[model samples]
Target: MDKITYDGIRNFIIENELTDSVAISLHPDSFDELVMDYLDINNNQIERPFEILGIEILQDSTGSVQKNKVNILNVV
Candidate 1:
């Protein structure tokens, strides 16, 4: 996806308090379509504009997942 589209999806996830792992369920074709569909339906009601730079997987010393580290920035 393009930068704007990707950023918009990231912003949507943040706005709805969803995690990256959520994509597992809505994968491949449906995820992007869902985001675009939601944007179209809601007329892009993204209250907070933000850019997701990256998602860092934080694992413990034993290699178990501790939590996810989302690198993000507020967009103007």
Candidate 2:
């Protein structure tokens, strides 16, 4: 699994113009667990609440299971 950093995720949202959207993960396996782990690791450093949108199964061009794609939404 690729390491997804907090800064990287936040920057993605900002760069993609998703400032008002909640965070999301599109991985069938352990998407929630990954998000929780991320939060647990950076719990003390972060102040603002980062909400998750939802989870879905994502695939690559070759039809292989790809890494979870994190997105955002305006509400839950």
- Model 2 CA lDDT for position 42: 71
- Tell me the spans in candidate 1 whose CA falls farther than 4 Å from its real position: 1-24, 47-76
Error of 1 at 73 (Å): 28
Q: List the residue pairs that clash in candidate 1.
A: none
Give lDDT per model, in order: 0.38, 0.43
After superposition on all CA atoms, what RMSD does each candidate show versus the true structure? 12.4, 7.1
TM-score winner among the candidates?
Answer: 2
Count of clashing residue pairs in every prediction:
0, 2
TM-score of each: 0.28, 0.40
Relative to the true structure, candidate 2 reaches a TM of 0.40
Q: Which pairs, if any, clash in model 2? A: 21-73, 22-73
Query: lDDT per residue, candidate 2, 2-71, as tens digits?
Result: 5444455555555665644343444444444445566677764433344322222121233243455553
Tell me the lDDT of candidate 1.
Answer: 0.38
lDDT per residue (tens digit) for residues 1-76 in model 1: 2322445555656675754443212233433454455467568853222113332112123322212222222323
